[model samples]
Target: MKLAAQRLIAVALAVGLVSCTDDPPPAPKPTGLNAGTGCPEFAGSGRQIEFGGEIDAELGGVVLGAGSTGVVLAHMAGGDVCQWLPYGQQLADRGYRVLAFDFAGSGVSRGHGVPLGRQVEAAAGALRADGASRIVLAGGSMGGAAVLAAAPTLSPAPVAVVALSPPTGYQDADAAAAAPKITVPVLYGAGELETSFAESARQMYAATPSTTQRQLVLVPTSAHGVNLLNPETGSVELRDRVTQFLDSYAPPA
Candidate 1:
């Protein structure tokens, strides 16, 4: 009996030790755009210009309407080529002259050293150069954060913004604090499975003081950044939601 009691105690202790071992915390959730594969084909006409290098390739934007309103699609951290191509094209088809380009280091854009703010500036410049008077800044993941960070710097100011799976404070609090400054109509979306970023999205929506027209749509059974890529499946729903938001705030002519 004594030996059996000792053996049972040892087993319990072993089980306790194993339970307390503490596996490494799960890998930090990805904050930036993750590169997928393939190149996005551009269908519109402008002038495909190289801004920096292979990464910063600026394809000529398609002019949708005679008006000055435009939408700039910002790429996530990795590159926008394969992932954002379909969505960009969809926006183009919707009659919004869209400018979709890679960041300096990530895509066809030149220079890998450009920071987030500079990328937003580049998008704004593309819009202004193309005669876009009212701009709608749209981005995914880190690109979403970039637009928020650059909001204050845009001279004419963006009329609205659409952020998909935007990270709240992965890097710092500045991005979160910038939320209040975004007074324009803002549309925010996230994957229901993306519990990691759910709180962040909520915080951003809650912090924004502008109640003009703000929305948060939690997509079910989708992964972070996947909805935009598979629009036919779930991405289409996201696009429609965004389009409706923009339609409600049609930019000034």
Candidate 2:
């Protein structure tokens, strides 16, 4: 009887041990988690900073990086600053101060507020007010069109523009009409399999005035927005190429 009890006890111990072996997941890294390299300190949601101000715009956003060059990341329609959180942090790590915001009627932002173009322009202005002498505007999808619309309105003008999966015509913003007005270098891209989106990119590139230096690339992958930048989708070189493109025009942060 004692042997039987001992066997049962051993089985219970084994089960307990197995259950205890399950480890919890690693803690989430803070916003602007650095690459172990020298990166700027980013004040995230806790900061409660408001940068967007077109129509009483109390739009919320995070500011990362302290480099001379600045970048504004515009999220796709129906999305907000959170969409660009990871990307903004990495760009900050790479020496560029990055600002991403929620437009009115999106995310934490409220009110009918201003148009997309005005919202993006306000964001770039806020970046300058924060002390970024040089700026680069970047976005995806509807957000791409927003940056394109804002580019022509910048005072000193953004050093360059990067648009991914930007549509040709979306509501009020017209990429064809705005393309010729882009005064700085531009890098536009889209997924080859995205049909209309890919065609939209081509149209924008062609409409871009011959006077401006512009280039377009079609990724073989069908991912949209920054997803087209994924290396796993055979676009391994896309990210580095973008960095190189910015380095040439904006000269890095």
Candidate 3:
């Protein structure tokens, strides 16, 4: 009995020591854009794509509108590529090539643990290779920060950009630093209720050296990121507004 009791205590001590050692936290899953109201999906538009793992995707019409422009949309942290379908369809209707893809760790593209910028790079490269003469980059929240982060790295560079409710910084992406380097027209949008988010937009706008045009929109909703783009959020005119912005600057050609 004595020997058994001593062995049990030793076993307990070993288990306790193992439990105390910290294991690294699990990888984060994308959220927010995963559900809730988002722009609708096109009935029969876009297609599947494969470039390092896989990406949910769509491609716009072949003929260019005016600038021969193509647009690439990156989704928010938790959401996948489907949410952008409605807007992408609109762009397609307007004669612009539109490409939307999942960001590796999210949606159907999940589990690659790829960094966001690499995903953007891959998407943009695919778009360019597929005949996009010029490109525009757009995103919301984490996705927004991602495009902004990718701005400087684009070889031919995007003609314009739209970042809605982007963070001031994320990981290697510092908007404050990046904004100055981007020499293109930009449309920055934010909601009034989220002070930090609105402030971040303002800071990014201020940092961007826009000689031609740069507009700041303060949407009247608590919505952050792509949620601001949703009509149900009460910012009904955003769709037209974005279309107009793109028309005036990066319109298809």
Candidate 4:
């Protein structure tokens, strides 16, 4: 009886040990998640131009029009528009060698905003220096206004002007008065909710000469600068509209 009891005790101890061994290991404490690089790097000429301390960095701008040509992409707002990889790529796909860079004090570019006219001249100079004889000036908000201010001064004048939510009357009265002088086919797009800017866009369209193929597009449910970055807010439609307008006015090679 004593021996049997001892065996039973030993078996109990063995069972307990086995049960403890079978227990799963405690879960490791979670480390914090890492930050993500927003978009992919742009691929292109890899060339950069330094104009008045602003570095107009080039990316994937080598792809030109139907004949292996390229277009100068001037991004007027702030930040490295290069980060808007999708926007640049979409334009690239449409036969544009996009020259997307920042204004001085904005992106990788080094300088700050000079006089509005000077800003336009500088941008035009950048395009001309890049060997684009027939240029298409596309701008957004401040950029749009800059392009408009710069258009008349371009040596040969830009082939077309596409302004997205451009601010009118921001500069002097002369600048506002000069908006009508843009004779090229002008395409203006704005969000329906952007009251002041939408009105400004309408004013610009109305002011332009009747000879100019002026178009005003009201993007439904889109707000100022909202669709510029967010992919979900019918940005594709906006891009298509701009591209179509550009196609109608692309300079002859």
By descending TM-score, how would the candidates be arranged?
2, 3, 1, 4
Compose the digit string of candidate 3's lDDT tens values, residues 1-253: 9999999999999998888786667898744223112323452445444454343332221111222588888777777666566666667777887777766556545434455665676677777766688888888888888888888777777888889889977766666678888777778888888889899999988888767377788876778877777777736665567778998988777
Model 3 TM-score on a 0 to 1 scale: 0.73
**lDDT by candidate, in order shown:** 0.64, 0.77, 0.71, 0.59
Error of 4 at 15 (Å): 79
Ranking by lDDT: 2, 3, 1, 4
For 106-138, candidate 2 gives per-residue lDDT tens digits of 776655737788788888888888879989999
> What is the TM-score of each predicted model, taking all chains together?
0.71, 0.79, 0.73, 0.68
Q: Which stretches of candidate 1 lie over 4 Å from their true place?
A: 1-40, 43-46, 50-67, 170-174, 210-212, 251-253
RMSD of 2: 12.6
Error of 2 at 132 (Å): 0.4
Residue pairs in clash, model 4:
44-60, 54-110, 55-109, 64-69, 64-70, 65-69, 73-99, 104-111
Any residue pairs clashing in model 3, and if so which?
A: 30-78, 31-78, 65-252, 65-253, 66-252, 66-253, 67-252, 67-253, 68-253
Report per-prediction Cα RMSD to one decimal.
Answer: 21.5, 12.6, 16.2, 14.4
The lowest-lDDT stretch of 10 consecutive residues in candidate 1 is: 46-55
Stretches of model 4 off by over 4 angstroms after superposition:
1-40, 43-46, 53-70, 83-85, 171-175, 225-231, 251-253
Model 1, backbone clash pairs (residues 3+ apart or across chains), number: 16
lDDT of 1 at 170: 31
lDDT of 1 by residue, 1-253 (tens): 9999999999999998888886666788634332222442343333333332222533322233334677776666665544565665556666666666656556544454456755666667766777777788877787778777766567778888887788874343255877887777787888777786666778888888855467887777455653554645565667678767888885435
